[model samples]
Target: MTKSEKTQIIESLTIEFKESNAIAVCDYKGLSVKDLESFRVAVRPLGIKVQVVKNTLASIALKNAGADGLEFRDTNIFIWGEDQISLAKAISKFAENSAGKFVIKMGFFEGNVVDTKHIELVSKMPSRDELLGMLLSVWTGPARYFVTALDNLRKQKEEN
Candidate 1:
């Protein structure tokens, strides 16, 4: 690629890094083409953009975006975009089966550089919508119990 083309690509990557909710660096060295395609298909449906970019280019883009703390190294494929936790979960799930074919390197989230273990933890976390639903269920538990108790009391009164 020409210098201008590389610059444009880097600019685009910088923009993506800036806008992303989370960014994960992974090694895709041993993945077969079919497996990689399958991985892409799985992640794309969840609105994640998975790109295999030169590690130097990614580092440069991260620096340009003032996110040098990401600390990506080696040949890295970047998985980033919307709904970061979902993307992480999808990748983690795929890796669980692929094993040695793929591996998590590092991740960036909320302006912090997360190691592989932290990335795995993030992957295990519930999505925002799921967390919200769980919180709603918890919040309504007392109300539900109160209503049930009232119904039982009315049933007893009617039987008397």
Candidate 2:
């Protein structure tokens, strides 16, 4: 690519790093183009963007975005999104089926460098929507009990 093109790519990647909640890096060395395209399709619906980036450019973007301590190496496919959990879950699922082709290098989430183990743990955790639903249930529990108590009182008054 030309110098201008490289500059543009860096600029855009820098923006992406700034906007994304988390970024997952993987070594997609043995994967085919078809596999990569299929992976992209799977993640696109989840608001995730996957791309193969040159290590140097990615390093520059990461540094520019203030992400400390991620080493970029050969054949890196970057997966990033607003929902960190979804990114982790999606990549984890994809990697799970890859036998040994897709390897997890590391990740950056909420300003921390998360290792592969942590990424796997995060992947298994419920999504943000699921967590929110759980919280909503908890929040409504007291209200439900209050209404039931009021109904019981009304029944007693009627009996009297």
Candidate 3:
């Protein structure tokens, strides 16, 4: 586009990347527009943003945002969000279903540059909500068993 437009985009993206918890650079070479749209829809609810940006602009933006060490090349689609776990999970799941058409090249997570394997590991980790739910279950387990045991004891005493 025009120089002004490019400048505006760079400014906005710099701000966005600065606020992001993680950014995944994916190679979406063989995927269709429809596939990309559906992927966008799927991750929108998770607060992830999907975009196909010029590599140079993206690199500048990332560098301006204080993230470095990533080199973008060849048809990259950027997937980013404020939640690293969700971003990793969503992109990894999409990559799994893409059948080699889409690939996870590398990522910037929490100030560190990571690879596909590292992204996969982050994806497999429990989300904040899932971790909270597991914690709640564990915390209430003993109380629940105690109540059940007390009820059973009362029933047996009444029978006697």
Ranking by lDDT: 3, 2, 1
The TM-scores, one per candidate, come to 0.89, 0.85, 0.97
Give the higher-TM-score candidate: 2 or 3: 3
Tens-digit lDDT track for model 3 on 98-153? Answer: 99999999999999999999999999999999999999999999999999999999
Clashing residue pairs found in predicted model 1: none
lDDT of 2 by residue, 85-130 (tens): 9999999999999998999899999999999999999999999899
Total clashes for model 3: 0
lDDT of each: 0.85, 0.93, 0.95
Q: Which stretches of candidate 3 lie over 4 Å from their true place?
A: none
In candidate 1, what are the lDDT values of residues 37-114, reduced to their tens digit? 888987887888889988788889988877767666667789987676897798789888997879988887778788
List the candidate numbers ranked by TM-score, top first: 3, 1, 2
* Residue 32, model 3, lDDT: 96
- Candidate 1 RMSD computed on C-alpha atoms after optimal superposition onto the true structure: 1.8
